[model samples]
Target: MVSMSKDTPRLDPAAIVTSAMRIADAEGLTAITIRRLAQEHGVTPMALYRHFRDKDDLLDALAARLLADIRLPAPTTAPWDEQIRAVLAACLAVLRPHPAVAGLVPARILLSEPGLTLVERTLALLDEAGFAPDQATEIGSQALCSLVTLVATEPGAATENTDPDTRDDVIRAKRAALRALAPQRYPHILAAADALTLCADRDNYYDLGIEFAVAGIRGIRPATRTSG
Candidate 1:
């Protein structure tokens, strides 16, 4: 380890990124700016620029931070599909807490070391599952994008109000509006009103979303590759 010296740059890149993530979690991606972060750190924008080129660099750093948090499941002799599921789950666990910045994932996944490791592992699993390198690249990208979209677009998730009571009220209002729609022409929608309006159980919502993703991949695999 390099010994600390008084000459060391006062601003830590990791520490600054952590603060930016916190700001994003509370406020929104649009709220993150070099000027704003500089104000938070009591430094001028040029000081922040030393660690980040600009806003885009900082955002990329945030995405790298999310990808770095993934606790990728250990390599196993388990079926490729099963291992892929575990990989997806690990990614979900990281991105769920920082939805605002999760949108940055697809653009940055190949740009970070941790993200590259994950992509490499995922592609290896796809190869084991019989997808050619080109196909695996496409499929892996789609699967990751699907997972990111799932977190970014979950119902009622974008709400600024985190208070449980306030959120419940909002859900109830939405449910009522859906139920109030004329039932004569929308019977199917009417029957599914509650499900349509509220993601009542977040865990189930994500579990089912993951299932949909896995099902799509399984359904598309070559019949000749069937394990059984």
Candidate 2:
């Protein structure tokens, strides 16, 4: 099949993965299958198998392609916080762009060159920001994984289902169910029901998280240095 590469007019793997991602995003991951991908491309199933051995191979390929698009910007000369913010923002944009893959991201084990590049870039950013190697790895892991978790749990396209009204109703209902609890045992929660029911603006929440993380890192750095 690879020998056919020149004459067969190779289908762009990146394009195939983009289309597949759209399907997964719209219909859920289970809807992604070799038959479906072939149909989407107007190609024979045999052609797809030539490109990817199976669904797992396709998934791995898709992840690597997605990561490739997110090459980290150089952090040279920028304040550490801004650099960190850039990384987080870039990562969020990349993951959010492929909502289907957002759910699968946390489970991904780096198996391709692009994936390795991403890991290296992340660690490099943390190291630049003055974190010890171990600390950098830990922080990078938590931040990147959290971005996937956030996007997967609250995908932009699925906002209607997770709207504030629906969320508040569920929370209130849960609070009401706890009515049987002795007031003394849960006094604070019971008293703060109204405050707890208040909804925070989603954009602000995202910004706040980024801000908090950057601030925490800055606080930990030495007073004489502002290089991070």
Candidate 3:
């Protein structure tokens, strides 16, 4: 592959984010550095500074791009619970494909237009379901946070590619470790050892969490307003 050099044309902010994402996906977030990006884009490190104030700024831009990739469902007559599930699923779908970027999400500001738009729509859904403004904000924030946590912590979700034998060995090792725990001291854990180490059926696991969140939201009844 031809390497970018200093003689190439100036790199735009979008190009910088794109290159950074590519590096992050191929290697890992740790591989993303201003100097590294500059080298990849055929520009001086100082040129990147012109586009981003610092690494944090560049990461925030990357987060924005990732959020922008989610395609929220259009307004529909679906139940509020279904609406909430749809939004969460859309966000997860985008994050799952770019696990490196997903890990940075908790630290990155979601003030970009696409991010705010998502927040706005989620709150609107809650409001329509009879939740007060404050309640909507709290519940919406918690739901989104829970979804991010799920994606970030999913087993092997962010791991770099590994050959089948190596991957199987890792899984076997984990299962063996879990099984070795004393049943007398950890009865529940011992009983669920197989489920704990199994990485298959992640979609079902994710759906279960979403269902739990939706059920919790439904259980919250809006406060009754009082007037003099």
lDDT of each: 0.86, 0.69, 0.80
Clashes of 1: 0
What candidate 2 gets wrong by more than 4 Å, as runs, is 1-10, 106-109, 155-200, 216-228
- Pairs clashing within candidate 3: none
Give the per-residue Cα lDDT of candidate 1 at 210. 84
Q: After superposition, how far is residue 184 of candidate 1 from its true place, in Å?
A: 1.2
Instruction: Tell me the lDDT of candidate 2.
Output: 0.69
RMSD of candidate 3 to true structure, Å:
3.1
* Candidate 1 deviation (Cα RMSD): 5.2
Pick out the ten consecutive residues of candidate 1 with the lowest summed lDDT.
Answer: 1-10
TM-score of 2: 0.68
- Global fold similarity of model 1 (TM-score): 0.89
Best by TM-score: 1
Candidate 3 lDDT tens digits, 1-228: 334466677678998899889888778788989988877777678878888999988889989998889899988999988998888888888887676688666455356888888888998999888987788888987887777777767775533356778867877787789889888898898787767766478888788878888889999998664445
